[model samples]
Target chain A: MSVASQDTTIRTGRVTRALIYLTLLLFALFYLMPLFVMVVNSLKPLHEITSGNMMALPEVWTIEPWRKAWSEAQIGVQATGLKPYFWNSIKMVVPAVFLSTMLGALNGYVLTKWRFRGDTILFGLMLFACFIPFQIVLIPMARVLGIFGLAGTTWGLVLVHLVYGIGFTTLYFRNYYAAFPTELVRAAQIDGAGFFQIFWRILLPSSGPIIVVSVIWQFTNIWNDFLFGASFADFSSQPMTVALNNLVQSSHGVKEYNVHFAAAILAALPTLLVYIVAGRYFVRGLMAGSVKG
Target chain B: MGFLDIDNTTKSYGPVEVLHEIDITVEEGEFLVLVGPSGCGKSTLLNMIAGLEEITSGEIRIKDQVMNGVHPSKRNIAMVFQSYALYPNMTVGQNITFGLEMHGVPKAERDKAMNDVAQLLQIEQLLDRKPGQLSGGQRQRVAMGRALVRNPDVFLFDEPLSNLDAKLRVDMRTEIKKLHHNLGTTIVYVTHDQIEAMTLSTRIAVMNGGYVQQLGTPKEIYDTPSNLFVATFMGSPSMNLIPVKLRVDGEAVVAETESSEGDTLSLSVPNPSARLKSYNGQTVTMGVRPEALTDAEGADHRSTHIEKVLNKVTVTEPAGSDTFVTTTIGGAECVARMRADTEATPEEVTEFAFNMEKAVFFDPKSEDRIV
Candidate 1:
């Protein structure tokens, strides 16, 4: 090639790369706009948030709204903090995530390795559970929980989240384990390892990436869920998301936009923290089935 | 009774039976190889022996103990899989000792066994590496180490070397042979590669279409295959099969075939079996190994009958030491192994010698040897 043509090619390459970066920057800004608004409004005084620009930075950055949102925000008839509700969410989510993830791992192992005659059909039905909308299950779930005397309890919410979240977690683990070599399981059996032994020793240790994906997914789902939390949680056992909704929609003498924004950010912190801590594994888990190691 | 006996064993999936009534008796410390093409039920038989698959009707006995309805772990067998099947998460040392750990062996004893096996397989340097970190050959060694540390009654190999590259496969093949010699454990190995079966087996059971076509020592199977399938499948540049009409001459039986140029060529059969008398005036298949057909100077001098024929060579493939010269006999392709220096060129007429002493005749209708 001539030098001039080579120069042109290099110039075009630079232009294309700059164009790609510019497009990505635009998307980044588009997605981050709501979080930016929430942070900016949460720091501003109530009058500044209500009367001034939503995009403008707070001239007087004070953490008073955050404190009030945490301890003094009025949620429904109660004027107490979102603190108790946050604890409720944690109490419900920890066990729900733990139990659901364990169940999903076992389900994935059995479905892939020790599959029975109708296992494919059973897995298909479990997969179909992931697509069902939450609205369809609310009334029936409420009646079932009521029958079990758990209608308004935190354990009821935990059970609800566990049941609903299992489908997605199982799907994640099942797809990941399907690509795993069955020879390992066979070798384990020949080595005198039984079912649980093979799973615990040979399979579970290699399940790091998928477990992270499932945990993050279930934590996010159970933490941010408001429908079940609102419908099932009593006032004393209301989750953070339900309390956040109540705080935002509750009418008072004047609107507390700063408190509402601060509450929303506070409610979102745990899931965001989970993603930030182990985001690489989440990507690896997503690409597990498509790319074999 | 042999150490491991599979008597009238059959395998079926619902309505379709894949393995017919298989009767194999493997003596203690014998290296028996089951070889066949894909879908020939060799691997299924190996699984049945390992107690991984349920026996359909017959009994599998190991050391005079019945093996039906037993779990694979209880059967005391270790299998090296084609994929190596190393635990991806465990270090090589841990993988080797996992079987011992499962059987509740003491840690000191397990370590001693692991060290011994690692040394035996020359994988001591790879003890700390995970399976993913090791190379293909290293992972295969670790797999063997895992199986060896168990010290099971029988070692089952399911095409274990099939995953390695050509050069590594030969090296591992030799290593496995040496290991078998040193350990002398009874082994039931399955493979589709006939060369592997011939090189490693003390006895070979060649299968086709769910039947054991022939079972014998490597030399016997190579010299006199029971049927046409075993004859064609057991050798490289496989045995050249020519359709020839049999005729009883004054004192000998002769096979009459045609050259590539449609010229008649007659070869006298040496020491004709009584069965050939009945086959006279009918067409039969003459099975001749490529080594049995050579250039005139390369013909075996000890053979009682040698016939020289000139045929047009269709192709000449020189593989280092031997040149495979292809020509047409009875309108079918035949290969002759000649010395590399032979002047056999494609599309040129070349003089070749056929050593009739080692040739076998088969009934074309039954596809079985007419012995």
Candidate 2:
């Protein structure tokens, strides 16, 4: 009788697990539906998209919409391409991410290890910077850019991102460093290592997960940003997101839904690639960085 | 001038003083252990010596040179932390050699030093392994190797064996003592373990409430503790303190204590000091070790003074070689050590002999030893 009862329990456990998996699969599909629709419609020809079902695979797949979205689309007054703006984004993001991450590392090291009186208050004020909405800073930043004659330039956009991104990068690194053992730093000091030497040899080498976290966080934030990009950039320096917005909204002719979808996908490729390459570290970094010393 | 001297050191944060006027001096090769319970400022003192924490007031001198504001590296000291503090990203070899590399030592010299330390620590096989890959004992060795490669003027160890298991702790304790003997380097170790302090130190500074309560050899601290706190803190199954009245009985100084049943027990004190003579008719504290009170037949009869007392046994705890027999005296629980084979059952009155030659007296109000 006990054997039969155990068998019944095992069978019920299996059925419960199966039901959980079924529910998860359905939720996964629901979340993926828009992405599926975007890819399907982006691949379809204009005539097929106009008449065929949205859920169906493209009856006649074509690369024309992707081509047009890249080179021939109208973005604002310019009809050049997203290719130039894509280069603009690369120029803006590379330096911005690199500079902010370096500054944040220094900030974190000093804030956590070499702290002085009022340092905690200073860090708290800096943390307040991370929560401020971009709209709140937009006007003053634009005015500052104008005063410096940096308005509507790639450098101006880089400056804007750097100023705002430092807060988040600092927060990430500070949390990560707070959990790092402090004895290593003291040991290095006694080993005759000076400040920068300790940072370079001892601290930086152990900062792999946090570096990934800060870089990816800054890269995605600057890449997908539309408000700052549009406000700070001009005709020649607009980022890919702003250009994509203009490309879809410009109504020189009938709406090209397929081209719009392709353009949106093209604009999102870099961030998606970043996630796919280093996605595992992202979660690990977040979890490890949150642990307090 | 002493090799290392901490003179009139006091540490305070805001208005709260943590360590108050601590003074310690060590010879060239003395092993000094600063021992106390947690929050007793032992680690704070060590850190101040290492220059990790600033000294608020007082002068710290090494080799007769003042070291008040000297950087830790410039002061030429190495520390073995409780956590080991090996660089997790570096291999054992690199960890050992990092100090040399920081001082701009040549690659050949660094490697030579690293090899010597690794061999000394018997960690040559672990040179290529990262700290994360090594066991607790191996990591401890690597931490020591890191400090050893420096060959600094003084060595600081902060509870270095506290993280190990019980068995490993004992093994490593012996290893550390052997290492100290082989090197004969001046060492200042901090620990809360009384046994570690007693076994390792050439001189022990017993700290309490941030003050150096007593500074002496382990034997001196154990046999002639200066006060009530030091007497109780240094021993296991600590020294039993019973309230007693001192009286002169026919030229012999005797301590009189009352049992729970209102019977008086008188034990004669051997060689009572001149200072103890003033408290003839007043109350005082009598501290006796459990070994001093034992089964009558097995008691050491060679002592000059011994008193037999009959008390009802309240409990018996057999601890392998000796059994601790507990009985009530003057409303306080007193333990007597007995031979394990002795049949002193609980609830039966047993005759135990008390050796009074080693007993000490403390003033009731001040708690300071009378002599």
Candidate 3:
């Protein structure tokens, strides 16, 4: 069946359709080429990657590079794998994503539903954090982390990401909850639902789309963050990104390209997997807040 | 003490006063409706009663207890919001029982209450459905069920049927009136609709510009409005106010106005009060309802005095049940209701009967009734 139906306003000719699909395919292939190179070379021996074409398939297929990449990354006198750093990233991300999203939902509910004087000004101040450059806050964040003695711990990274993630998460949730009927909150109030109960039962239950948007956003940002990980974390607790950087920097004179490729993909895998699973919801969630009732 | 007493209550947003010293006592089983045009502080007063809004000054009492700092749920009040405001996540049964559940009612008790309210609202089959899945009318029932399940001391309805279609609104209006009749619950209903006020309210507080213009039974508000605003705001086509000079003769008082054809039409005033002496030779407003000024045959049979006058019809609008004949009387546009097959055409001279017994006069300066 033709997609350009009788009611479609902008009808395209067959030639135009062919040209459009060709352009889309070219862009898709262009974007996928790096991922393609990494996967193909990571399967081959290191010599084959250095001497062979990036576009060529691997002839000497071995899983040794994947295994070494998974368990062997040199960081500060220890021959530790990416595994501990991977755990560090997970430890940082889970708490940061969950806490930031929950706190954001609460902030949104209070700002929109239980309004007080100067609330708009307060909201504007909260939003100012979202636009503040990350580099500007690093010194102060480091000082605060040092004062709290969380300077090089996984929790320190969690705190940093949580503090930064709150602004964007609150923006998403506040705008989403603004469209939520205040009448519902008032009705729940009359129904004797207290502040926390109203948030847990009424507003949060209907906050599925915005929550997905927040979780994906916070997860990707906290997982892939390099500067925060490098600055705040110690050698023992550095996240995957920092460990990957160290591994590449300390490649022992001769380059181990296959292990590097596999390590790079390993560092990037979680976020990519997250996008594949929830990519549609991210797009849908963006639209839902702006348009859906 | 009354069931609900709003004594000297006022609400102001910062410096701007929205409700001014509103004092009204609602007895048990009284369906008191606060009706007005938009932004008239009706809903604000309702909210104040519900403790959803703080009373800027003075006191509100429910069951003889001051409710100034009380939380809404503690006030033993339930509200049906304009949007229905059902918890979208909950089923109809849960929606109805959420209040009871929050009050720490047991599971069995909550279930029983929900079932009872569902049957009462005739929404038993909709128990498992979410609010979004229900139709607007069904959602309205669920909202009412939520309110009714609480069985609070007072039921506050903030334009609950405003979202329904016209047909459903009328049906719901009847159902609400029936429910009030059966339950005899003290209700505070707020609406912009005068028809709903007339149909459902045992007593209505006609409000405008943050003031209650009149508070009385529907018949009293309709027949003897206390001011010009109440006269115009309470009726569908609204009461006609014509500028007329009062003539005080020996024993007869007459409302003096000139007809469209340059003929002086003198209509007699009924029950001429001692106040008529003060309004003599003064241009006052003659407030008469459209139904009071009709074709002679359609005039009220019990009306003691039906004064006849000739006026040129400006327009004849043929409504299905009746015709509204518009004409210039005393240099002001006035509507006269007549039979559906009203022969009065535009630009034609028509003889109209004015029910002098139903006539009221307002001092045009202060705009208050002069009786």
Candidate 4:
């Protein structure tokens, strides 16, 4: 009887439905306001952006700001734009994301299926690492990079992000793999598969959702990182976030508001593109391991 | 040595022992079932045989080869897990042939083996389909196919049918039995279901609290259960343990109990076991199966003695095929398996034809059968 009564409560009348959608649309536009400002202002010339209303459509559209932002704008006393630093961010983010996700996966597999004594404690310490302030590790991380002769290099940034990103990636993959059936691993063991074989053939293939979650998470975190970038990276190997900061702060006379806006949009593009492509999976992946199959 | 020998095996976790010393030898082509309640260590024993869990003590040998410290794959054993554990990413064909591929079998040989297993399991149509695309029964078949493809010396089944619907469980049970019959493989099956243990295994090891309570054939376990737990645990609705006063009636021992009508109902114990003589004058339990306590028309005519007692009926459940009549005997609720048209109803005093020949005595103190 209660179930039958729940059927009517599940549905809304036309007016209620329209009101709900209208409220949702209003919230959507409210959140999209910053992107709207950036896009509109970025397409206008410097004079128009300086003189005209920020949210108003450009009277004379121009791509000069974008072109300058891509190639000719002064970033940290260099007129090399955000292009070189963009590639640096890509180089750092890709390997960092790939290495961290893979290492996290291997750590997750070992922690869950091939358990040893004090493994929980080890996992607890790793989880504790996730909560540690990134600022606290910066000094030690810089020293370690110095010892390894990788300080001020793009690879140093890669190593820094990889180490920092491991905790979160392991947390994601571990939780996801924890819900995975141990019987399958045992079955694979009985089927004559070795450690890496079982991981590659059985575990990795089924880890689609969690992998997306890890990649997207690592990509965004590494790309958008400002603290680590500013603290470690030199002028040559500075990532996009640090370069974007220099681009915004370096101009002495004219503000170059359009150029700053254009550079800012470029700095935020990859993460935005990643979210646009795999955002749905991010939510689904987070929900997957929280509830058991 | 038998095909598979579990010789005095014990399993422990630090200070706690989960499975006591268990010893059972299984012949080649024999089906042995370990049936018990949850937390009874039945699955632990099966895992020991499969080399899944390390043995705490004693030896598990397959075909005279000591299996301690042996890898699971090298032990020539394949297990069907409770969840079926089909690799979700692999197609039916790849899933079945995984073991062969891992063992470095040639691709052509692995493909042939996979095809043979798929054909044997009648899953030829689902070859290209992933495990996620298959239904529960189909996944079960694929699990079996994976095991069957290996054609190992011993097959271990860990509650494999438990994940299916009741109807499908029964169907798969029959099919597994048929497959065993045709293949003549040495299978060590583990289930908490006594009916599955009864219907499938050539022999059964009824376990409780990490102990093998009784090990025997189905009829031996059913008719002559070694202890009180085995007597009650192996049957549906279980055996009724009626508290009765034992008294020597001339040459025979008689079990006397207070009926539902508040009258004395006496049942004779013919040809009592020699050890049962010591139980005279003491209050003991009389274990009787539901079928043994029936109406006049429902009684087994072959039995020489059918003690008649008029007891008050408490409940009558008409279950299509057999009507189960509930009545009180010896201060315990007893159920009698009656015919579909059984005349007994609640509140009415009906005559029960008790088959004393099927009754067994249990000592109240030890909780073991008075054998």
Candidate 5:
């Protein structure tokens, strides 16, 4: 209405837009800088990598490191290297993700739809178990695995991953299921669907985002785990994470930057591929729990 | 045997008692509505009948067989939820046929049933689409289709129209009534809305505080409420209740209020019982529905024959069909529904005829109807 007021409004709007742009620019840098450095350095030779400025561009780019890492990283037991261990990681993670997702869906369905005495206490215990650190369960879980003669096998790690993964997966599912109306569950019951029938046919079909979330979370956690892999399995059954630790992280090495960098990239590729595939569902699932529909 | 008999049924969750001594016997092909405000145990009662909730203390018999411990799927009942609980992943056809498939119906029969219900609900074109693809009203019809395909002996609807918009709700309400008319299946519906109760129910059970306050046909419940709660709950704009002292003026009973006309309005009740006559000098509550009061001269109804009471109208709300005039009578505010043609200015004293013929008297202490 007035010249001064109109001028102030325009100035304020411009400032707000500028502030938003500045904030986004900073956040993008914060997330992408490390990734950019890793990709660029992975292409550099040892001399170029060790010449001190790690963030600087390479003098020459070559795929030699990737080639060497794959072959020299041994696809067999004698070498304790990347290729064999990577396949082992895949084998271990696939089952863990599948089983964890299925069990999480079941847990969510029961907690939200079924009513019984002490259901609250059971839910509270699950929440409490989620807050319990994995460090506290190591000895007891190892002992249990030893009794089953699965202490050093891939199946043993699968069990461990599933045990730890259920806490988070169930929490994700339980909260998601809470948002669904109880009437839907009742209708399913009246439709003559049994427990497993409802889970597989009715509930699971609509649980797109939650299934993706549980799979991605369990796969990433199992693939990235070094401590559990080292403690639970020996060299033969060891996953890439543990084997990579011996290859790149052992203090006795002469610090083969090329091999270390290449191995790190190789190990991270699975999770990166998973994120690219399930990125949308992961974000949708997270938003569903925290926001109104 | 009755079509569905719930005899002395009760439900309690842990320490919380939700329903008490519920008894409802729905005749074959009858439409029953359970109407009450939230937490009044109407939905719980419906759920118990549907076998969704466990009955704590009595028997539920369906066509002479005990159904108290039976699972919901085995109860021979179909329920339409308030959320229109159509499966999001299944097509409308798949959703409708799911119940029949679970019951081991042959493929041919299931298809025929699905097609029949879809055609009946006029959703044949939308049968291939998922619930998410359809609009709210379409999803509701699909839900109904699912229930109808089951061909259960009884249908239970739990506030099915509460989710729809006002216009959509009206349309669905009529569709449901028409569906009942065609199917001739017994139905037990639950809703907090009184208008739905009045329109959809063949028999309305008004529940309050975990008890059935009154149960009757919609007209009976509306015209002759058993108690103060039913009288107030059944009607829109509610019934106007005014406290007055009953006294004998010569040969007739006179209820006098100083604030209203500053005098007594003498009237007589036919065959007054000893209990009612005992309160001759005591205070009682008189309830008059808004529709009962009109422009004294316009309707020429029996309401005109009673004593003419003069009062000042404070507000006149003209709602298309009728003008709701709020006036002060007997020191209390009373709403009278007049013909839309009636003209009255605010703050002007007007003569409103009283309708004693349909009016009810309540014992002020207990808030129960007095015979």
Candidate 6:
């Protein structure tokens, strides 16, 4: 309200604006630095890459390594390479993401809203699944899949991903739906919305951020899984993650560092794209269930 | 015939009984309010009528049809919850029409119903917005609109305005009363607010501890409460209760309180009823409201001549319109409503007058009204 205060307020506002821009610029560089290093390393020859100064920009850039990674690295469908492996990853991860998220939403809706005999016990089991070490069950799961004739097939990895993904997905949705008003469910019941109808019409449409979080979590988990894919998938049906590991592990005498980096980038791109697209909803879902009216 | 009848309804969750032998009949156009404090089984009773909660033992009939075990939607009753419960993702229009849409109402008819309700509630501008975008009053209107669009046989509201701000609560309270007046539909409303119960109901059922303490017209319940709980619960700045022994005069019963200075002042009860005959020479509680006590010399002639009762005003609170004087009498503090002109300070002895006609008596043993 005073002239001196007005001058100080304007000066402080200017400084705050500059600070915000500086913070945003630093954030951008933090996210971009790794991708920039990967791109530069993929373009350089082997000698320059191993020169121990990994941070420097390439003196000479060439597309030959990209071409070699595509052709000699054997990442194409035409020659049983990374191309078929990528398609195999998609085939397994898509169904796993879809089925796991659907089942998680269903499980969460029932655990929080419905009062059956053993619902609390079922919720305890779901929470228990989240804490148990996956390595302990790996052999048992492998044997079960083998008995079902699902081992060495895309369905095998899909089933495995679903089994692991459902625990976290259901936890995410159960907490999110807990903050919802119980009266909404009761109102729907009074309005003739039976179990599934209440889920689809009343609960699902309101579950925007939670659904995004479930999809992103399941997709990333299934896409990046090396142990399950390598253990269950055979040579013809293996995902790109297994193929990338084989290329790195099976090389003899000389290591193709450029091809390895490119393959690693390929395996990671799907998950990175998903995070970029739905990161806001994932964070929003984390904050959704902490408050109630 | 009654629109809805509840016959000897009892509810319990295992060994914890919530409601005991609740019998109520709702006429076709009555606005009945079930009023009580929290944990008094009002909401549980409302849920039973709506078929959302199972009645432990009872028969509920709506329009001559048994409603026990009926699905909530099949019972033809719509409830507006205290939380509003508007679907957060749906527009107000969609929320109002959700029940209708579920019952297979055509889109055209649904649209018309939505328009009519929006117009009725004066919320036409908010129809396209979700519940999160609206104010508390607007969301409350949308909730009411949802129930209104159903055109069901009965309406149940469970403390629907308790969540709003005080000013908004009063505004919506009038709006709900007007809606009930216009609809001529059977409505069973629940609230802990005695003011809302007093102003809005055709009849009120006061409950406490799984039992109906009293059920009658609002005026009847206010003038003659059935028990001590009803007397204290129905009034703001509640009635003052004083323990005293009754002495029999020639043709009347006189209540005598032991004075602090070792003396006794006997106040005569003019019309002694038969209930007072058994209570003579026995300890009982005499209830007097604040408004019934005043300065002995005050201009209100009706209260001036009852009998001179002297007590020390211990605390004084002047709330602009009236002054509340707290005084100790017979080892209990009794609050009296005095005019602002009375010059009474703390711990000062003052002569206060009482209107014995308005005083109620309750048996101390049972806590029930003597008559």
| DockQ of all models, two decimals each | 0.85, 0.83, 0.87, 0.83, 0.72, 0.70
In the range A178-247, model 4's lDDT, one tens digit per residue, is 9999999999999999999999999999988899999999999999999999999998888999988888
- Model 3, residue B182: distance off in Å is 0.5
Q: Give lDDT tens digits, candidate 5, residues B1-371.
A: 68899899888988878898988899998999999889999888888888888889989999998998798999889999988888888999999998888888999999998888888999999989999899999989999999998889899998999999999999999999998998899999999999999999899999999999999999999988889999899899999888877876545566666444566555555345566667889989888888766667644454434546777889999999889999877777889888887877688878777766767789977888887
TM (chain A) per model: 0.91, 0.93, 0.95, 0.94, 0.87, 0.84
| Candidate 5, position A34, lDDT | 81
Each candidate: RMSD: 2.4, 2.6, 1.9, 2.7, 3.4, 4.1
Question: Residue by residue across A31-96, what tens digits does model 3's lDDT show?
Answer: 999999999999999888788787899997898988888886565568777888899889889999
Q: Write the per-residue lDDT of candidate 1 for residues B1-371, one digit (tens) a residue.
A: 99999999999999999999999999999999999999999999999999888999999999989999999999889999999999888999999999899999999999999999999899999999889899999988999899999999999999999989999999999999999999999999999999999999999999999999999999999999999999999999999999999999766998999998889999999889788878889999999999999999999999878999999999999999999999999988999999999999999999989999989989988999999
Highest-TM-score candidate: 3
Better of 1 and 5 by DockQ: 1
| lDDT per residue (tens digit) for residues A12-34 in model 6 | 57788999899999999999998
Report the lDDT tens digits of candidate 1 across residue range A1-293: 69878777645577889999999999999999999999999999998987889999998998999999999987777678798899999999999999999999999999999989999999999998899999999999999999999989999998999899889888988888999998889889888998899989988999998999899989988998889988999987899988988787776667889988999999999999999998888988778844663
Using DockQ as the measure, which candidate wins?
3
Error of 5 at A187 (Å): 0.4
lDDT by residue (tens digit), candidate 5, A1-293: 69878777645577889998999999999999987777777788888887768888878988777766666754333444477888889889999889988888788888888856787788788777678877898899999999999989999999998888888888888888888777777888899988888888888888888778888888888889887898898766789887777777565635767767788888899999999999888899788855632
Q: Please list the residue runs of candidate 5 whose C-alpha ends up more than 4 Å from where it truly belongs after superposition.
A: A1-61, A74-81, A249-256, B247-259, B270-275, B300-306
TM per candidate: 0.95, 0.94, 0.96, 0.94, 0.91, 0.90
Q: Point out the higher-scoring one by TM-score: 1 or 2.
A: 1
Q: What lDDT score is found at residue B236 in candidate 4?
A: 91
Each model's C-alpha lDDT? 0.92, 0.90, 0.91, 0.92, 0.84, 0.85
> Which DockQ value does candidate 3 get?
0.87
The C-alpha stretches of model 2 lying farther than 4 A from their native spots are: A1-23, A74-79, B249-251, B259-262
Candidate 4 vs 5: which has more lDDT: 4
lDDT (Cα, tens digit) per residue for candidate 3, span B175-272 = 99999999999999999999999999999999998999999999999998999989998897989999989999977898899899989889999778
lDDT for A22 (candidate 2): 99
Write the residue-wise lDDT of candidate 2 on B337-357 in tens digits. 899987899999888888888
